[model samples]
Target: MRYVKWTFYTLIALTVFAFLHYVLPQHDIVRITNTDTRRIDFGENSIFWASPDAGTGAAQATRDVKFIETIQQNGRPMVYRNEDTGWIWPPYFKFNSYNLQTEASDLRSTSADPRWVVVTHYGWRNEFFTIFPNAVAVRLAEGPNERIIPWTNIVILTLLAVAGIMLRRMWRQFRERTLDPLFGTAEEVWEDAGDRAGAARRGARTSWGRFKAWLRSLGS
Candidate 1:
């Protein structure tokens, strides 16, 4: 049971970690190599994609998704989709897909004379599943080796930690003031009942011994 409880807790922690990792904005310093748009058909991977452009209805199961292709500082290829979140979950509130695409296209560079930029995005790039991270914003970087501090992530995580601590403290206080006292009272009652039962058994045994002695005296 203890192992099972720990396993359950570990699973919950991993799930939360995965959720935050996918939803939170991440920074990547890369050189924009190309920008293009592709028509994608919705399938099982549709949930990974955002909704239609802002103020537009869902017209069809397929739409043109803009993409920004880049080369990382390590020379590996990376691709990101540009789309409007449009009042959806994760709440990036991004309605500037076209603008971002233009910016990315403007920042496009070649390997010989690369212009590094920081791409703020969320989601994972999986080739087997054909899923790409959605780029939220882009900005010029100082250099290829720019040390970007994830201040947003740090602030969000700190607030979450503080909230968790506060919740735990509240639960402990509730248990101490309410549940613990109720259970403590019940436990005391149970111990008192056990003591009374033991005493009654001892009294009955003494009376039986006295009756046997009286019977033996009368027989003699």
Candidate 2:
């Protein structure tokens, strides 16, 4: 049971971490390589992609997904698929796929001029899974060596911490108000039962002593 409890806690922690990593916004300082739209046929990996265009059916397997191509500070190629999250899961509420694609196109620069742009995005760029980070916003960055502080992450973690604390307080209050009183009543019942048992034993002892005295008197 102890091992099972620990395994359960570990799995919960890992799941929370994965969820935050996927939902939280992250920054990538890179140079825009190009921007294009491709008709992507999402299959089993459809979950990685965002929702289909707003007010449109999500049944189609093939759609024209806009993409923002970039080269990172380390010279490694990174591709971001620009899509509107709409009013769906992850709740980005982003409906500016066309605008972002245009912005990415405008920000494109060669390796020599190197117009570094900060891509604010969420999700993961996994080659094996064929998933790209969904770019949320973009702006021109100073240089490849620019330092970007993750204020979004800080605020999100702080809010999560507050929520956890609030939940813990609620649990403690519930235990004190409900479980503690019930347990105390049970404890009192057990103590009262024990006292009754001890009194009965004493009563039986006194009766036995009286019988012994009567037998002694008859013998005398």
Candidate 3:
């Protein structure tokens, strides 16, 4: 049972980590290589995609998605899908895919005159699933190796930690005020019953001793 409890807690922690990693904005310093639009048919990997642009109404099973291609500082290739998250999950509220694509195209440069930009995005680039990270914003970087501090992530995680601590404290107070008293009362009742049973047994033994004394007197 102890091992099972630990395993359950480990799984829950991993799940929360994965969820935050996917939802939180991440920064990548890269040089824009190309910007293009591709028609994608929603399937098993559709969940990785974002909702339609604001005021675009419901999303269809098939649609065109804008993509920004880039080469990272380490020379590794990365692709980001430019789409509006609308009012859906992750709450980026981005509705400017066209503008972002235009900006990416303008920032395209060659190796000799590389225009490095920081791409703020979420999700993972999985080649196996052909899912690309959704780009939320893009801005010019000072250099290819610009130091980007994720202050947003730090603040959000801190708030979450505080919330968890508060919740645990509330639960402890509830147990002490509500549940603990009930259990304690039940224990007192059980102890009292035991004491009464013991006293009854003692009374019975004393009565038996007196009856035996009367029998001995008669025999004498």
List per-prediction Cα lDDT, in the order shown. Answer: 0.95, 0.93, 0.93
What tens digits encode model 1's per-residue C-alpha lDDT throughout 1-220?
9999999999999999999999999999999999999999988888899988886778479988999999998888999999999788889999999999999999999998989999999999999999999999999999988998899999999999999999999999999999999999999999999999999999999999999999999999
Off by over 4 Å in 3: 190-220
TM-score of 1: 0.87
Per-residue error (Å), model 3, residue 115: 1.2
Which portions of model 2 miss their true places by more than 4 Å?
A: 55-57, 187-220
Worst lDDT run of 10 residues, candidate 3, spans: 50-59
Residue-level lDDT of model 3, residues 1-220, one tens digit each, is 9999999999999999999999999999999999999988999998899987667768899988899999988889999999999878989888888899898898899989889999999999999999999998999999877899999999999999999999999999999999999999999999999999999999999999999999999999
Q: Which candidate is the best by lDDT?
A: 1
Clash pairs, model 3 backbone = none
Q: By lDDT, is 1 or 2 better? A: 1
Task: Give the per-residue Cα lDDT of candidate 3 at 214.
Answer: 97
Residue pairs in candidate 2 whose N, alpha carbon or C atoms collide under 3 angstroms: none
User: RMSD in angstroms, candidate 2?
Assistant: 3.7
lDDT of 2: 0.93
Better of 1 and 3 by lDDT: 1
